[model samples]
Target chain A: MRLLYQILWKDHSRVHLLGAFLGTLAGFVLLLAGIQFYMDLKAVLSENRDLLDPEYIVINKKVNIGNTLGLTGGGFSEEEIAEIKAQPFADQVAAFNSNKFPVQAYTEGEQVPNFITDLFFEAIPDEFIDVKSEDWKWDPEKGTIPVIIPQDYLNLYNFGFAPSQGLPQIPKGVLSMINFKLRLQGQGRGNYDDYNGRIVGFSNRVSSILVPLDFLEWANEKYGYFEKNDPSQIILVSKDPTDPSIIRFLEERNYDTIREKLKSSRMNIILKFVLSFLVLVAAIIIGLAFLVFLLSLQLMISRSSEKIRRLNKLGFHYREISRPYILLLFLLMAGITGLSLLLTSILAGQLHQTAEAWSLDISSSLHGVIYGTALGLILLITASNVAAILISTKKLCK
Target chain B: MLEQDTSGSEVWEAESLLLEQGKPYVVEAPSGRGKTSLLSVIYGIRTDYQGLVYLDDRDLSSFSSKEWSKIRKNKLSFIFQGLELFDELTAMENIQLKNRITAYHSDERIMEMARLLGIDPFLQRKAGILSFGQQQRVAIIRALCQPFNFLLADECFSHMDRENSLTAYKLIREECEAREAGLILTSLNETGLPNIDHSLKL
Candidate 1:
């Protein structure tokens, strides 16, 4: 209405403009920041998938002062394994089997000169091994043994050990081609055996050299020196790693976990928790900002209450009296949202450059869905508040 | 007609005083005799009184605030004793504000009313800075800017001289006649209105 326009134009004040602009800007920032945090957290979680399996985790007994001084050893007892298996989250648990005899390995080939070194081997259940290479299976009757090595071991050799020793770094394809010869010595207590050892595959899940369970048992039996011993490390398959109870149980027992696979997953879990907490805080701030806007509206209306009363006495309906206020607030929110989106877009450009530098796969852009959600939520909350304030003002017209 | 009390006892009364459209009535009273209270009751601004007031045989007390607003918008206009105009607005703005409510008057008609009221020269002056008599003329013109079936004036001419009061009353009477509206006025002395069809004393 022309009357509504005249009233608004005549009553414009700096106080009103400042109050509305600041409240709207604060609310816009909170919403945009919260949404950006959530998106970034989602990207981090997705990137962690290549680092760790969600269902598989490796743990060992915590190393204490007694363990270092040889007063105790860092190994899992039978009762401890039984207790772990009884846990509700634990779907399956297996221990790493270590050879109990002295062993040495060497390679003699054209590309790889003869080099001899002491070696240790470990074995786990075939079902727990993620690498599906057919050659990984070993039989005592076979002439050669198949082994799986950690992928990072080659990296350490190529970057750290080989360079220091002035030797050529062994590429994965060439390493798999050469057969490693192993000699088991029993020191006159039992007969020694010589076997050909070949690398079958590399596993990201396990960080040690892996042999077949059958092979480790046969070799330990043939070169028996002492009684069988308990395992020092364990691999557990859980239904859900993100369950808080699982972490609590591990911490309560003072167990140490392999950080390689769990490093990124653990970070993801923590980041998700932080994301939720930040969103709740942002919601509270937004709620306060909305109250500020409503209070500003109340102050403006109170300043003009006398004119409003007179208008009402002249038989102008309540809607006519409140139209200008609702219109002004709607316009303010629209403007603030537009400015926030512009700023977010600019910030997203910078985020893309940072992501590229970090070698992250995340695309730095504001998703339309998130923008649409933020706009819808802001307008919905503000409109409801405006309607409530107007209704209360109308009630006071008497 | 209805009579009621501001204190414990009735101050004035009349028997079956009927106000019809296109008629004029004058109520005479001494000072502090509830003349303004009587006009306020008729205008639906005062309800804390005893006695029944009716319009078309419907009890006035039964009307809701919303219904009273409708009556004020389409059927009734009032000029209070204080000439209750927005003090911050100019004289012309005061008239234009009322016209905006009903849109019943054109610019030429408003100008003609201002000329008749002798307030055309002061139309641009703020009401609060002007003399009480000038504001009273402005309020009178504002009252006529809306469509009405009745016009109630509660000693609206107290600050004006007799000449200006007569001129303001002439414009009011002409506007009321053109719209077939009844005029109910109270005065401490004679209003000098012609053809007084009804009379009351309080």
Candidate 2:
């Protein structure tokens, strides 16, 4: 067997085999690294989402000139709301209900400055509200309306408004303690009623000033005079915010939302595209490398054609003659698999370190799918090459 | 039985000719008379003939490649006219390449046969650099390194001098007698060697 190897292996071109080895290794590293990073990024994207509650997306039509001039309504019609309700991503949908009458608020408290301001109110289903409080209900007998204001409005007043105005910063507890009166007015003169209003909670989900649904319904019935208009805002609950179709649908319909909320979904689409392209290029390289490997072995066998026939004449089977070639192929394939995996893991470790600087959690090791892919591809290449070696060597034998 | 005309031949034209074991037969024919072809057909290398050939009552063409491989390893041996030696291998390695398959001969026995054929000093050299006579002696030793019921020597001694040819023939005869195996030696002309009892002419 050693003599057979010595005689047969002498015909192989060293440069050809080395080129094949390096080419295959490069392809394997590319493929494995693509898979590794894709998995890690997907994990990181979902991990960030898990820190927040289920996604609530608020969508509104893009305000164009036509909407500003009243040529087209700046609101969602019944058909549009129904269509949004029918979407697969919208697990729950609600349209904002606004007060159909004018309202003005005045603070009459010693601890707070005297001020009067016009206010608008919107209402949605209580289930969609992020703040859960006992005071969020409507009681006509109590004559107190519970209002939920956006967290951003308060932050703006404290961080942007009050500091520049030389006004003292008010804490949330102090602000909620102030008493205010809301005067609801009817269409006719001297037809108005004043009721007490209290701030119940701050909402991170909805950007509008919200009141209870029942309270708004009662007030609109009492003081309603303006014509009805379609709701301008639609809030929907989604279980999986990383569905890229949400962004595509919004863009196609000319709808607008907070872009930061769907960052993961947008990142997902881009990641998939980049990874697929990487895999395609790697496949081409691996394919060409595989062809080179097959041809190189076949050429070596043909160069040793006379020697093989001589060995066969001496009672060495063609299978025996193929042993050296198969052994060489096995060694090269194993090396590619091992070295590619090692290189991909090293790249992953470097990526993990870089992501750590950004406080992004990325895995430092190769994913399990990377090994499955490498092993599966290596076996496929080795099996086909071994078959080719057997076939060509048999052709040379008696 | 071959594709050529066989009207004047003895073995090809005969109705029935049985060559027995433990006997030596010399097939004498001029060039282009199928001397090598006859040996090749019997060795199962050439299949262009029309008639049936049998080995121990089993049809020769009925054997698969695996069966032929086994027969070549353990049952039949041929010293091809082309000498079929690996030129890159040392003469001893070439011999051991065949001997390792069956382990039929010890290293000392191979060396003894090499010395008898006057090729002992050239055993360690690559067969490609040796003289044709030396390479022929190497092929002879390689052929004898296996166990076979019949030894087919296809003009193997054509390159050797008369003295070396006699010495090699003596060594072959001794090996054949020890195993009680038959010998079919093809030659272009008559060899006046003494012990061959049968000679067939083409």
Candidate 3:
């Protein structure tokens, strides 16, 4: 006990105390950012709603970072889809067709020029119907279906229900959608009529409208490059890591697969490229935060570790050394995290109030702090540091 | 084992022979003839060198790590080489901390240790606020609280005057006698640890 204190105090008091505190600040924020980044992206791209979340299927190759969708082609061939469904890890497979809705409208007579591409929608597997968010329930009686949009769009227009006159009114029958929107347009504006089926539900909020793939396929035939075309779609793999997606199993471990299959070769590169790119960007951001965290951990270990060792040498148990430092770190990190959240809240509030569009609900949320935004400053200042301190403290003890 | 090398294989290796249970051994050596190393081994920190260290007639090597740690806590004590003392704690708190770790019944051992070393005067001051000499004494008092078969002092009295040295030496000897504990102290000069029960010089 005495020995641990001696060492901790020596380093803490003389040189590294301030550094430790600041490091905690850094660590907390970075870790928070990693989670937030994942979440923010997840909040955007995540599929599924009230049932199985729709999985995304990409090529079985290493996707490059910063690049998405190299080539467009035929959807997964029947054989490939069959193989995917056959795997133990497979949930279910369903073919889908998607097209951009660049222009959208509430009234049939006019269109909102800048409303831009609503995310491509698909006919999801029955399993994925409820797992994503708030599933859209089809109303066969009224022949009316729910429309889902990215929550970003809702936030943009004030929860999609703001009474202001300048923005077009959102149609009432739309279901919920996710909060983010991805723009994949190369040219020509698409309108809401692009979908074939009526929207009956939402995975989240209305960022984009989702309906069965039949609707989008019809629209693509009506508009996309090929004539009489039933557009091919990217295979969506919905397997959780703990429960590997069928595609993940087949993709990993140099397995026996359809060698050089046409669909696999082209779409393989494209899908793998897109998903991997997204995952990679997410990973790099997190990895950078982790690296900084690790370095800070090394510093922390160098500082307090010797002291802990000395304490252990003096017949002190692990708990004796660990308890005090843990308590100290908890207190310090709590303060930092609290202060950061507070600061972020204030900033988000002012941003919402002062900046017009960026203040959308997802950006400015409860107390004007969105999930990621609320924790951003703290994550920036503290999360990584907390991890760094913990890891370093643990390492030092060993 | 301070006569030449620390272990038996060295050219002039001198090993410590145990005195009767309540005696003091003064050891003298150069800055690094394993004085602290020998003390650590006795308390079981460096145990892999060629050694036959036995505690209560049992080889230390045979004990499990947990068992060794338990014996070290209950049966022995150490004054660290760097005079490692908690900077955040008061001098009195430093002594109290030692008692807290060994988990003996709460008593006035802290005050008792303080009074014995005359550290009671600086009891309320943080260790960081104390002078080196005072810290040294507090470190000594901290080591004095453990109920043990041996107290290992690592160059504890190198900076003290003869009178202060004599005071520390007398207190250590008296405490050893009272508890039937042995004293094994290291020094560049045999200023504090004295008398002739067992002597090893390198």
Candidate 4:
């Protein structure tokens, strides 16, 4: 009845109801926005992964005092290589093969400055190298050794060393045209051979100077005299570079890698920690707001206790008398649901705009899970508040 | 059977008593004679008395709150001595609160009864601002707006003067006769009313 509602609704404290409404709304918006941002960031993190080939990580033992003193070998043994191959993150593993003999390279043409430098060579299977070249092969009869050096080496020389040394920076094509001779030294002074060497490509994946695997094997067989040592470095390909276990496993085994390669994996761990903490805080606020909602409604009902009993005496059932309170609860719940979703979507839009300046692709709309979570939580709060309302109202009636 | 533990009483001390339909019964007693308690018991609001009250062969104690609500709506009505009117509601709204549920009386008939009880000018005023006699008249009109086999009036006319009491009582009798319902009117002293076929001292 209109009069029934007018009578019962008059006793409600406007401050209490408004406080409950705003409190619940604030809690819901925080929770929903946290979820939306988390999903978007996760998507963006994985999206960048799709732009590149699978990650190749080069790992070596940490250099400590024992390794410096030559007391311990700073390389992977047969058992250690096998253990690394068995790891879940290792999709493919290859050990670096080094030259067992001494080597030296010198420029012979006037187009480049005459220089001779001692060098060491390391080689892995061709598939792990990022650079592709037809000249990356060994031919004993042709007597030409093709070499691949790190791109960072050239960059360091061009950017750091050339300007300080008053030398011109040579481009890659000019470097390729220069002719050089490599002298391989065996056990005796006369037991050596010289071969022509050429720079074929620069590698971004591996940091050391590289030669074709077959040429290194052949040269080691012919000129090797020093004691054989374990491989000093191993390169592994991982399809999921964002897997945090890659970093954890490396740390546990005292292995080191260029940390820039696993930046995404570290970011993923940190993002998960921060988002979970955000969700936990949201859950606590929501829980406390729910209590305020329950108490506010209960207080309203108890304030109307006399009118409810009077209505009951006039032939109104307890359920009938509880109509006003139930309607109020429903209205507030619906408002919270609608407003929270709107606020979360606005937040998502803001994040999308900010991420755009960084050239990151982020979704501006809310995910389906956001809607589902909002509805589920609102239903939960509304149902419990409704039960409390009915119970308190029934207590006041005959 | 109806029973209670009051000495020097006719209805309470009696082994059994039956109040029939289409009859007006006056319960006469001084203050503190359990007049309101007797009406409340019959109305299913009080169950503490040591007695068995029956309506149409059904025990009063057996009725659930839902059933009691239904009974109150269609089979029983009470004009409580406290009036039970919403103080914030206008007199007309208080009457319509009950009338709207039953839809038993039209607006014209309600206005006519208010005019007869001399509360017509105050119908639009809040019940809390009206005098006790005016609030009592509103409660009388409210009780008469429902369909009931029994009308329980617990000293409802105590606030009104003799003439207003007689006029309200006549209206009650007319409504009861029209529905063929019974009336159990309790009073603190001798009311000296007319057309009351039975009087019980409690």
Candidate that scores best on TM-score: 2
Tell me how each candidate scores on DockQ against the true complex. Answer: 0.37, 0.73, 0.20, 0.73
Report how far off residue B169 is in candidate 3 (Å).
Answer: 2.9
| Superior candidate under TM-score, 1 versus 2 | 2
Q: Runs in model 3 with CA error above 4 Å?
A: A1-283, A322-398, B1-23, B26-34, B62-69, B80-82, B86-90, B103-109, B125-133, B161-163, B186-202
Per-residue accuracy of model 4 over A1-398 as CA lDDT, tens digit each: 78877988898898988888998899899989988988888888778566457889999999999999999999999999999999998999999999999999988776766999999999999999999998989998999999998999999999999999999998998888778999999888698889999999999889999999999999999999879899999999999888889999999999999999898888878988888898898898889889988998898888888888899999999999999999989999999999999999998999999999999999999999999999999999999998998898888777
Docking class of 2: medium
Model 4 chain A — which ten-residue stretch has the worst lDDT?
A: A44-53
Q: Which 10-residue window in model 3 chain A sums to the lowest lDDT?
A: A175-184
The TM-score-based order of candidates, best leading, equals 2, 4, 1, 3
| B120-191: candidate 1 lDDT, tens digit per residue | 899998878988888988888888878888899888889988888788878888889999999989899876
Winning model by lDDT? 4
lDDT string, candidate 4, B1-202, tens digits: 4556556689888878888877889999999888898898888887787868888889898998899889999999999999999989999999999999999999999999999999999999999999998999999999999999989998998989899999999999999999999999999988999988799988
Task: Tell me the lDDT of candidate 1.
Answer: 0.77
The lDDT values for all models are 0.77, 0.91, 0.54, 0.91
Judged by lDDT against the true structure, how good is candidate 2?
0.91
lDDT of each residue in A1-398, candidate 1, tens digit only? 66545654455566756665766576566667667755765666555554345468888888899989999978999999999989987889998999888888988778666999998888999988878887877666777988889998888999999999998888888888888798887758557778899998888888788998988888787785755678888999975665556776788999888655455456656776886776677677667767767777777777777777776666666676788888777787777788777776677777778877877665577877668866787678667867875785586453
